[model samples]
Target: MTVETPPERPPLTSVDQVNLSDWDFWARPMADRERAFALLRERETPVFFAEPVVTYATPGEGYHAIVRHADVLAISRRPDVFSSGQGGATNIPDMPPEFTEYFGSMINMDDPRHARLRRIVSRAFTPKMIQKFEDDVRVAAAKIVDDLLETGPGCDFVTEVAARLPLKIICDMMGIPERDYRFVFDRSNIILGASDTEYVPADSVDGIVGALLTAGMELQQLVQDLAAHREANPTGDLISSLVNANIDGERLTMQELGSFFILLVVAGNETTRNAISHGLHLLTREPEQKARWLADVDGLAPTAVEEIVRLASPVNYMRRKVTQDIELNGTRYRAGEKAVMFYWSANRDRAVFADPDRFDITRHPNPHVGFGGPGPHFCLGAHLARREITVMFRELLTRVPRIEAGRPERLFSNFINGIKHLPCDF
Candidate 1:
């Protein structure tokens, strides 16, 4: 898994190393991150540094940012060594154990626990269910296009278009009431957007922590209520399936159900919504590429979807803990140290992608880590996310041929590459 590193530039100073973990560093424009990671990749393929202490978690020695594609893939494959359970899922410092378990879903668990939960949840998304989901996606896409056609030539694409499909699909799949969609959407945004001022406008640690706790509590209460209702009156949705799911006489506890719901709402919704938003932005920026795709969206979808995922890299990074002392390439990592796989950087690594920076909708051999690397942790929703993105774009391009997106109002965070809003015209 070793990569040939470029010759080191003048060694990074203490100040330069410190910036790597600072939230302000991530809040900079996407291009800034590109330049920073490029410099690190060339001079220090696997750099070790401490994470900046955020208001929500206790400060501690941080992680090694795995920037190369080979290293990222290798680490992702060997989940036993680079364990998620030892630390939390995000690159942030550790939170209270209860908080981590309540919010981390199966993602933060290792081995048997992750395996058991995945198995139960997997049953709900069987081939038959996925086919139905795909059909539902197409119908949702068509309806979205029709609405946009009636209301546009102009709208906020993030709100009016890109964000709608995932939200609707997830709510319907979970059997959530239509009235609760806005509440679920808001809470999910707050949870993911904790670092952003728009969601948590606090200068002090206590204020930020308070906001986050409040949001988490509300979401948890809602899910718990829903679980109780589903238990009493089951329906043909994911919640009901999870409510009654049995594997060797084992079923999900109320706590596990709540966490799974949170994960589904955030991961299932945010990843695809951001990808669709970024896809519109990419196409608008590269009309030539847009034209090529518009010429045959259905034909180009397989590759186009991969390109969008790669370029978006919506979920920026996931943290892993070193199970024991190890050396990667020339860098030595001790047991309990953290490794943050920068999928955003790996997707653009020259070793894997040709003309890595270019937006090529027809890219082949696109083994992007956008869904995540191989392992038990690879995204369960990957196929569904792809279908949603493919169908939505196909419908938009085919039906609203003249539609275009303007500059995005980006989300301010290091964890998620989110687009808060995008002005668009048809």
Candidate 2:
């Protein structure tokens, strides 16, 4: 297929144009390293690969990295040129076959197909639906804060509170059994583990991938059963809604249903979990900012959301392949080459964000790419994710007056940046 081509980007310095090989494409480390590198890239070159030898392929080959704020915003707006269909699944590939196949199911699809699937469930995630979640979010936040107080100070908040609340809510929304909450959480780690190292234990690389496959397989069976259940016993939950949801005069097929179910579970669970963890980390790190936010709960909630999303960027960078030979930023065009957009870099562009490295909670008129770019491929669940974090912070500040990060742990995957152990003393 001849791919739509983006106009040639402006020329870059020799240092900025160094080729990045496959193995060198994504160098996963701690959260701090990513922050530093992102700042550096924005300073030197707005768009460049993570390593030399830009043309190499363990999967997709030869791709450019878009880190500048303007470029990301521009590309995100024009879905036709920077379309996410086909390989637009996410930058990091090589997870489970089921997940890969499921990516092709809908969300990553471009144009008519994406619009078709999205419109089907768009009602379920509409403004009203998002607003209605406040009650659930409040209850969940209260439960977590209460649980933390009952346990007292010195706890890994990410495990005890941050990740679980959203995971639980998302599972509840998807009609997943409570017993399987941890299973869904575990699988989500592997699926989005593209950028962190926590997913890969020492000498246990395959473990992550295995968990992903197993989870995807189990989710498939569970969804199959749920669809059957919905058929017999309809309810008002998302699963039931999806069961009856139709697009283009046709209901979703078995696989499409399964993919939607799994994506909702993974997307909602993982992204919100990171936002909560990162938000707490940011607040605890900056007591003054946290206090200000606490004082102005109603006003600071949105800013807090943007700060955390921009700071965390939980999903990390997604990869895209060039369908045909094309030149980009003075580079020669070559067919079947691979390139990617490193969102980690885009959110920190110096030109867009003042003092890009500093975590500012009250950043005015923030235009961060925490929710991806504009147009058709923008994140649908951003509303829910932001709401969950805001509620958690509002409740958390009420319960815990002072907080500090005790000990922190990050994920092993290079794509989904997250914290495995965020010990916080409150």
- The number of the candidate with the highest lDDT is 1
Worst 10 residues of 2 by lDDT: 51-60
RMSD of every candidate to native, in Å, equals: 5.1, 6.7
Query: How does model 1 fare in lDDT?
Result: 0.82
Per-model C-alpha lDDT, please?
A: 0.82, 0.68
Q: Which candidate is the best by TM-score?
A: 1
Where in model 1 is the C-alpha error above 4 Å? 1-18, 203-206
Candidate 2: where is the Cα deviation over 4 Å? 1-57, 92-99, 194-209, 323-335
Give the lDDT of residue 408 in candidate 2. Answer: 59
RMSD of 2: 6.7
